[model samples]
Target: MSSFRVMRCQPLAREAGSVKKPLNHLLVSAFVYAGLGVASGLFYREFTKLNGFPEGAFTQLGLAHTHLLSLGFFPFLILLGLERAFTFSASRKRFGWFLGLYHAGVILTSAMLIVHGCLTVLGLESSAMISGIAGLGHMAITAAIIVLFLALRTAVRGVERPAAVAA
Candidate 1:
């Protein structure tokens, strides 16, 4: 055991600068995902009103809403906030991977959900291919989430004190 004391950790020289490219990609992708979420909701509502809508189809479209917002909008929105607070470019490679995997997962999951929903509407049974694609999408999403957590966990710089606080 040791006496408690306040300590400071400084940002390194390389952990510098605001990067626009990643932020742009995050924002743009979020907007698109947001749109897809809204669109899926609309489709879900309309699809329900029609007779003989496959019961399973409802579940699939419902997931579109969930995955789009959670996988797409959620992470990007958090990253946008993080952008102002930390220099994520400090770990550019990791951040790039997070963005890539995340976007792909969001796209795949939502696309698969849409495909499944359409099949339900058409009264077609879900096939092996659809199930396989959905499974892969889920895996990608899980991987992306892990990457996001790891990237943020290590990349954050120690909090700097304000002049008033320091004084």
Candidate 2:
């Protein structure tokens, strides 16, 4: 009897508010990521000659640029499109966590990669520290991807249930 009551309560609790808001947040985040990518690239080009083609500088900048564009920009865009195409629920917490992780990963990784790379080129930091920062950035990105996937999957499942019919 208690099990049945708990089971009944679970479904009711899950059936909450609209999930559109989170999806919109993801879309906006994607656009911002795209813009960031472009800005980074432009800066790289402008500063490359002035900074000199120091070892690892170009490589780091290129890695940061690619990650920003591919992971940061495209993932959110794809999420938004998926939400629209599948009509997924827009659970705010679900989407919020995903966006938060995504943005945090991008910002941290990009910043570290750029700064460490530049510092390395300028002969400020040792190679090991730069490598460590890059590794941390990569881990952040991986965590963000996991969060996005889980949120998307959950939202899609939520929307697949049949709507209650009126008598």
RMSD in Å for model 2: 8.8
- TM-score versus the correct structure, for each prediction: 0.75, 0.70
List candidate 2 segments past 4 Å from native: 1-20, 54-58, 86-89, 161-167
- Alpha-carbon shift of residue 4 in model 1 (angstroms): 17
lDDT by residue (7-66, candidate 1, tens digit) is 544333442235666677768878888988888888887776674564554467667887
- Which 10 consecutive residues of model 2 have the lowest summed lDDT? 4-13
Candidate 1 ranges with C-alpha deviation above 4 Å: 1-18, 47-57, 157-167
lDDT of 1: 0.72
